[model samples]
Target: MRLSRYFLPVLKETPAEAQIVSHRYMLRAGMIKQASAGIYSWLPLGFKVLRKLENIVHEEQVRAGHIPMLMPTLQSADLWRESGRYDGYGEEMLRMQDRHGRDMLFSPTAEEMFTDVFRSHVKSYKDLPLTLYQIQWKFRDEIRPRFGVMRGREFLMKDGYNFDQSKEDALHAYNRHLVSYLRTYERMGLQAIPMRADSGPIGGDYTHEFLVLAETGESEVFYDSEITDLKFGDREIDFDSVEQCQAVLEEFTSRYARTDETHDEAVFNALPEERRRVARGIEVGQIFYFGTQYSEALGATVQTPDGTSVPVHMGSHGIGVSRLLGAIIEASHDDKGIIWPEGVTPFHCGIVNLKQGDEAADGACEALYGSLTALGLEPLYDDRNERAGGKFATMDLIGLPWRITVGPRGLKNGVVELTCRRTGESEELPPEQAVAKVAEIYAGI
Candidate 1:
C-alpha cells in the first residue's frame, strides 16, 4: 500500500470531542469519523484494523470447535416477544416499525434469534453440543454514547450461542469459551483479566468479563496483583477435551477478580492486603453459562434417548470486536500514537524513504516493499513526495509493528534501519536481513 494512493486523512490537531486517549488518537489518526452522536464511519485504516480483529476472533472461535455463520443486523421483534424480553429490554434497543407496521429492532443481541433457529431444526440430542457464532454489526442505543468505539451506539461484535443436552455439557462449553478468549486476547498483545461480572441484560448467573487494565478504562476493577503475571503463551490446547478446558478455567479464575458490578468488598478484604490492587479496565469479551435461560423461554428442546423432551442448556459469549481496537490503543499506545501488536496490525511493516525521489533511496524502499509483499506480507510504503519528518510522523501515528528506513546514506552503506514500534529501538542491517527480521518477528506471532 502506497501512502500517496492511500486514503488516510490524518489530522494535525486533535478533535475537541475526544475525551479519552483512544478516542483522541483514533480521531487524529483519521481512523474514524463521527457519523452521529455515538456512531462512526470506520475509514479505510480503521476498517482494515477492524477486519483484522474480526478475523482473529473467527480463527480462535473456530479453533475452539465453534461453527461460524452470519445473522441479520435487523431481526423481527417477534423473537424477543417470544422470549418475553421485548418490553423488558428497555430503550437501549432501537425499536421501530417496518413499512408493514411490524415491530423490528437493530439487533443488540441475538440470543432470541439463535434459540428460534435451534428449536425449529435441532430436535434431537444428536446436535446437542453445537456452538454457533457470527461476527456482525450491532446497535444498542447508548443513552450517552461517548468514547468513540469504546461505548458506541453501533459497533461490530462476535456473538456465539451454544446449546447442550445437559447442564454439565453447557458448563463445559462455557469453559471452552474462556480458554479460547484468553488466547485470543493474548495474541492481540493484551492481558485481559477474566473477572467475575454481573451479566446485565444478558441474564446469566455464571459469567466472566475479560478486562484489559488501563487508567482510562471505564470499569473500576478489584483484583489480585498476581493475576498480572499469568500468560497463555504458546501453550497447546485441546479444545475438544473437557478436562483440559475445565483445568484452564479453574487456573485463571482461582485468583480474586471482580468488576464493580459484582464487587464483594468482604471477599476482597479477606485477601492479604499486599496482594490486593484496584484499577480501571476496558471490557473486551465475556462468557456466560446460563443453563436453559434462553432455551426454556423460546421452547428450544431436544429429545433424549429415553423419548423425553427437555429444554436444552444454553449460553451466549461475546467479544466486542470493534471496541477491541479502542481497548488495544488504550493499553498499548504511547505519546506518539497507537503501537499495534504484530498479530493485529493492519500492515505488517512500513517502508519509509527518508529521502524520497532520490534514486538510491527510492530504489531501496521499492525493493524492500517488493520483497515484503512478495513474501505475502503487507508493507505500507511512504511513497508520497513528502519531508522525512512528515513521513516518519505518519508511520509513528499509524503504528506498524516494524519499519524499514531507507535513505541514500544508509543505502550507500549497504544497509537499511529496522525499527520496532513498541521498543522505539533501531538497528541497521542489509535490506534483505531487515525484511527477514520483520518477517521472522511476525512469523512467530
Candidate 2:
C-alpha cells in the first residue's frame, strides 16, 4: 500500500475529548472516527487490525473444536421473553418496536437465540457437546460510553454457545473454551489472566473473565504474578483427551485471581506478600457455565437413552473483538504512539522513500517493497513527497513493526537503514539483504 494512495487521515494535535492514552492516540492516528457518542466508523487502518483480530480468534476457537456460524444482529424479542430476561436485562438491552408494532432488539448477547435454535432441531443426546460461535456486531446502550472502542456502545464481539446433555459435559466444554481463550490472547502478544468474575445479567454461578492489565482498564483485579509467566505451549494438549485439557485448566485456575465483583478479601490477603499484584484490568474475553439456565426457561430439551426428556446444560463464551484494538494500545503504547504487536499490526514493514523524487532512492524503496510483498509480507510504502521527519512520525504513529528508509545518501551507498519501531534500533543493510533481515526480525526466531 502506498501512502499517497492510502486513506490514513492522521491528526497532528490530540483531540480534547480523548481522556485515555489509547483513546487519544486512536484519534490522533486517525484509525477511527466517532459516528456518534459511543459508535465509531472503523477507518481503513483500523478495519485491517480489527479483521486480523477476528481471524485469530476464529482460528483459535476452531482449534478447540467449535464450529463457526453467523447469528443475526437483530433478533426477535420473543426469544428473550421466553428465557425470562426481557424485563430483567435492564436498560442496556436496546429495546425497540418494528413497523408492525412487534417488539424487537439489537441483541446485546445471544444466549436466548442459541437456545431457541437448539430446541428447534436438536432432539437427542446424539447432538450433545456442540459448540457454535459467531463474530458479529453487538449493541448496548451505555449511559456513559468513553475511552474510544474500549467502552463503545456499538462494537464487534466473538460470541460462542455450548450445549451439552449434562452438567459434567457442560463443564468440560467450558474448560475447553478457557484453554482456547488463553491461547488466543497469547498469540496476539497479550498476557491475559483468567480471573473469577460475576456473571452479571448473563446469570451463571461459574464465570471467568480474561483480563489484560493496564492502567486505563475498567475493572480492579488481584492476582498472583506467577500467572504471567505460565505458558500453554509448555503443556501437551490432546484435544481428544478431555483430561489433558482439564489438567491445563486446573494449573492456571489454582492460582489466586479475581475481579472486584467476585473478590474474596480473606483469600487474597492470605497470599505471600511478594506474590500479590493488584492492578486495573481490561476484559478481553469471558466464559460462563450456566447449567440449564436457558434450556429450562426456553424448553430446550433432548431425549435421554432411558426414554426421558431432559433440559440441555449450556454455556456462553465471549471476546470483545473491537475493544481489543484499544485495549492492546492501552497496554503497549509509548510516548510516540501505539506499539502494535507484530501479529496484529496492519503491516509488518513501513518502507519510507526519504527522497521520493530522487530516482535512486525511489528505485531502492520500490524494489525493497516488491521483495517484501513477494515474501508474504505487508509493507506500507511512503511514496509521498514529504519531509523525512514527517515520514518517520507518520510511520511511528501507525506503529508498524519495522521501518526501512531509502534516502539519497543511503541509496548512493547501495544500502538502506532498517529501523525497529519497538526497540528504536537501526542498522544499514544492502537493499538485497533488507527483506531477509526484516523477515528474521518479524519472526524473532
How accurate locally, in lDDT, is each candidate? 0.93, 0.90
**Model 2 TM-score on a 0 to 1 scale:** 0.98
TM-score of each: 0.98, 0.98
Measured over all alpha carbons after superposition, the RMSD of each candidate to the real structure, in angstroms, is 1.0, 1.3
Model 1 ranges off by over 4 Å: none
Q: After superposition, how far is residue 410 of candidate 2 from its true place, in Å?
A: 1.8
lDDT of 1 by residue, 179-271 (tens): 999999998889999999998888887999999999999999999999999999889999889999988998899999999999999999999
Which candidate gets the maximum lDDT versus the true structure?
A: 1
Q: Residue 146 in model 2: shift from native, Å? A: 0.7
Off by over 4 Å in 2: 234-236, 442-445
Query: Lowest summed-lDDT stretch of 10 residues in model 1?
Result: 436-445
Q: Candidate 2, which ten residues in sequence have the lowest lDDT sum?
A: 232-241
Q: Residue 262, candidate 1: how far off, in angstroms?
A: 1.6
Q: Alpha-carbon error at 191 in model 1, in Å?
A: 0.8
